[model samples]
Target: MNPRALRAAGPAILLVAATLTVFAALAYGGAADPLATGDPGPFVRWGLPVAKLVVNLSAAVMVGSLVLALFALRAGEKEFDAALDVASIGAAVFTVSAGTVGFLTFLEAFNPQLSAGPEFGAQLGSFLTSVELGRTWLITTIAAAVVTILAFAIRSWTASLFTAILAIVSVIPMATQGHSGDLASHDATVTALSLHVVGAAAWLGGLVLLVVLRPVLTDRALPAVLARYSSIALVSFVVVTLSGFARTLSSIGAWDQLGTPYGGILAIKVAALVSMGLLGAWYRQRLIGRVATAARAARSFWTLIAVELGFMGIASGAAAALARTSPPFTETPYSTTPAEILTEEPLPPELTLDRWLTSWNVDLLWAFVAGFGIFFYVAAVVRLRRRGDRWPVYRTVFWVLGMLLLVWVTSGPINAYQEYLFSVHMLGHMLLTMAIPLLLVPGAPITLALRAIAKRDDGSRGGREWIMWAVHSPFARVVTHPLVAAAIFVGSLWVFYYTDLFRWSMYDHLGHVWMVTHFLLSGFLFVMSMIGIDPVPYRMPYPGRLVTLIAAAAIHAFFGVSLMMQSGLMMAEWFGAMGRTWGPTPLEDQYIGAGIAWSIGEIPTLITAITVAIQWSRSDERQQKRADRHADRTDDAELHAYNARLARIAERDAAGR
Candidate 1:
């Protein structure tokens, strides 16, 4: 097919592909079959999945267009404008589809009578207001509606970027709702599915944007755009693959479960994923350059994109259908323990020395974070070395070590047991806020990224451009200041604990993620302002930094002591009522946790202070060495002039007297 024709037909192709695949899969998996009881009738059984498929596809286009526009196309340019328009349209569709699905789901769940009467309206309102499922989709629809307006109105880089982020966030609620239970891996499944959904959206939508924009793109521009999109697609593929695998593993406990209908749908989705990956690789490696130089190659590439979008549609449709089909194995062991009731997972074994190193409850989200963090840093280092631009080996080592430790803190025994043990929770907190930052600050990731990322000259913002902007932005300057950073790093602990935020973090996954991110960033900023190798807008003098550290440490210790001497356990329902059969009493464990905060946490602070002192010494020595070199070069003229001026001033003073 000609490129022009292909571009115009892209949306239709994906729609048809998705429509066909979803209907087929739903039939094959018995998803559209009438429910044994509480069936909302066949129309809803079929229409709900179709609406969901639309939701997924439209969300993909919404997220993908903004992402590509932000990273690949220049603001105020035609292609950028077109991308945003596409995003707006996609968001509008997404909003409508989400609302439809939300209502249909209410009907599916309650089998309520369809009517516009007051009683029916009241029931629907209750569902939307009170039910988790109803509220989730309602939130999703509202978010998409907002994104639609933002995407249409925004033309600047920062606004577009934020809109894209908001668009991604809109899909996450949907990711959390699909077929899950009280299984231990429930959180992991939700997390993995969220990632998978976002990744696949970016991958699918970016390609669609490319086809949409090809007519508008100059030959010279297309290659660069393709290169940037390829990079995005590559990362998305990895995330989608890993998260999908984790999601699948959580769903199917037995190998033979693959023979089940749900598994069959999964196999179809997997096949589509594999096909898309292989096609992406082939074109990314061979076609992008050739397309820049040869028209024939361009044609072939366009044709391949058409095919790729079809596969993506198939994958997405399969995913939507899969959500409707019940998983093969959800026979989680029934338990009535308080811990299980509260957390939806069994209480872990007692914290022992052996389990500290041996146990792991991998948080898929942070596992990917560590994985990507290490991969990009190492890749950047390798790029520098290959080009003979130097990056310190020790920096690389520190970064790797920090990332590994992050994995341990997030996925190891600390994470596994923290929900049940206050002391273990505090241990993880200390590591996240102090020890991990200590290692990571020395790595100087910002410095490495600035040095490694290629500067784009096409008036577009790429990774390098955005990083520079963020580092130099007003927010960066303020927060990275020593005083401000110290305040946030230390003050937030008290604020978080004293407020409902602490309880929220314990109960909600989103709140937990926020807690982790807040501390990590606050700690990074504080450490960077003190001893980090990364460049910041401002830094306190060595003596001032030392003073700040001392003040911060003293306050930290006092807070810890206050906790240790508390009259009652913190988060009483959570910590005191876990019904554990091992370890110390709840109040005693709280004391241990507080002791850790006061003592063990201070160890890293001591280490940071020592590092600051060393840096100060080295700085003074370097300044002196420079002064000595200047003296040697100029025969001590500066010092002689200073002495003569002082002598003349003294003589004048004597004469006046």
Candidate 2:
């Protein structure tokens, strides 16, 4: 490393030292101890959290730097290359730390004696291969190792994108293996923790990347990059804040639990986060612009960055300790009821009409999505209007309505009951895949964004560039093909329900997220192919589109018929096992769901067909108007030519006779 690079590493060195000091103090400060049985030695107990801290730090470094590179840094530029190098280092540390955590976790859980023997090898092999927790860590370590090499080797945009994705995936095992997984609200807890971990890493890592790149970036480039980084940090702050609250709520049973040591540490972490947020706001509002104009402001910028790094270190150390600290609510598995045994959570109250609107079981993922969707869409429309650009009012209305419905479907009664009732699940599916898209597709969000978002001259990719890239990419072309979109829209129903995917979605939070995303995208693509005002890869002729829609509807109806005709329960272990005295029995609810799939589901299909027919009519009318205008412009020359040809044919016949 150059002298400049060594100087860049100074803040991070301070960060690590600070983090280790706080983490060690908290880990050994009566906050965490081995469970009574076979208490692992202090080394094992203390080493696990410390190892986890390294894992967190490394993950932040890997994910955050790459994210900034993708979002802010110009591809093939010196700063971008430096960011990748930073990521490579982070990935290496991530691999080592993850491996250490895996081994130490094995030791803690098994309390196995260390010896050089075949039997010991056999036990270690079983622990790594046969055990879930052990296997998770083993997988995480291997993934990190792969990323280490990939981040070091790859410099291309596409390769780096995939590498960044791999980096994110490497952390999933951490999210899944923790105490959060066994909590009462398993889905919420896992989602929250996963988001928190990723968000915090991105925020801290990007800040670190900025500090490291300070020496390489020129005065003009520095402020622009800082502006970009500020945007990322702002978003990360929101996600980390929200996900933290969700995770905390899942762990602590009541407000009174704040008095507990675990909660006290959480409070400290929250305080640190708030301090960092304030620092970020100060830099964004005050320093970022001035840094480009005044050379002296650079020092102030670095000072703020150093303080932010300190705060981030405190939060990281506290978080590592929090992982080991026992929350107020213990994660003791409950089998008091069959429902609890099956769902890993107790059943909610019986379903009612009132409860349909009132009950809320918020999925933080969808909540944030809906919130951001509304905020950005409204902001874009307002921006256009302020510039005297005409954006249809109805489009904004439809978009807002769609987002609101999304929140309601994901957070309100549908989510509350979907896992328990097949009928409700089907209803949610129809809304997500059909009704919501109908509202959202016509909004032409891509068009609005293309108009509202400013174009960038720098080689660095931003929100607008990324959105454009995705829309025009090869994958988008294939998916947005009318046949492919229709197939996914119609075929996915049978494939998801008949296959293990439905069961997976019920059993796993990640699977549920995938299911929602797949259905939403499928519906969006299909709708966009038909009535969308925005640009697309391809769309068929209006008649061909109508045929596609009708065919898809028919296939969709057959799927409903198949479901109705089923003699056995789908995922009997989940829906059938939810012990309840609800309005409908499990089998009966399945039949109701089938009816919903066929009948209520077709409402949006009918609307789509009507939309296609109307558009077809308008298209023909527009074509006719164009033809008339062309004829007017030509002054009847085509007609005169036709008459002359007839005259020549008549003259030739007369001469021959």
Compare the candidates by lDDT and give the number of the best one: 1
Clashing pairs in 2: none
How far out, in Å, is residue 638 in model 1? 1.3
Task: Give the poorly placed runs of model 1, Cα more than 4 Å off.
Answer: 332-335, 646-657
The lDDT values for all models are 0.91, 0.87
lDDT of 1 by residue, 530-560 (tens): 9988889887899999999999999999889
lDDT of 1: 0.91
Q: Look at candidate 2 and tell me the lDDT of residue 25.
A: 47
In candidate 2 the C-alpha lDDT for residue 343 amounts to 71
The residue-level lDDT of candidate 1 at 195 comes to 93
